[model samples]
Target: MKHQPHDAPPGDPDSALAGEAEGYLLARAHHDQARREAEDLCARMPWLTAAQAEDVARHYTRKRIDLTRQMLLSTVERASQLRQEYETRYAALRRDLLKLHAAGVCAALICLGGAGALASLLSR
Candidate 1:
């Protein structure tokens, strides 16, 4: 599941509902994936007793879930860091662009003023 950053302001009911729904879906998907992995592991070692297999499946599932949670948290953290870095860079670029435009306007005005002064002197 792709994680999306929430855009709604705090205290918005719709955003809260959407967040809850997304959380539910993510949890369900993770559980389903862990179950499949556990089953696959059990299938590979069919000689084990039923009780032992069950125990092994439970342990494997727990570990898999924990690992997946850690990885997801790591990914989310990195995504946040990247977003901050990008936003900062974008702001700096916008500021530079504004400065360049202001400089160009000033240069154009200076050239026009110089031409006007030269024209007045020639007329005199």
Candidate 2:
């Protein structure tokens, strides 16, 4: 058996580690992209002093990160809503199917009872 870390919970440490690693990689990629965008913005206006360029880069990076965060939050909220709706619809459909099945069974039993009664009357 493989060993688990004492601080970790009972299941699948590998997946947890993978998720953390993926998050760090994405954060790094976003930072790199923001840095490149900031550089491009600074390059467009060559007249600014060093301090002014630095300020612009800082402001641009902050705004970009905030916008990305807001978009991710909105996407997560929408996904949650869709999951709830699909689950409710699935439950309703299952209930309808069960009701139909029960009705079919009852109909079959009634037909069998009528046939048995008819056979008894014919014999008499």
Compose the digit string of candidate 1's lDDT tens values, residues 1-124. Answer: 3334467677777777787889999899989889888988998998998998889999998999899889989998999899999999999999999999999999999999999999999999
Cα RMSD for candidates in order? 2.9, 5.9
Q: Which digits, one per residue and each the tens of the lDDT, describe model 2 over residues 1-124?
A: 2234666665877857766777788978997899799989999999999999999999999999899989988988898899999999999999999999999999999999999999999999
Pairs that clash in candidate 1? none
lDDT of each: 0.88, 0.87
Alpha-carbon runs more than 4 Å astray in model 2: 1-11
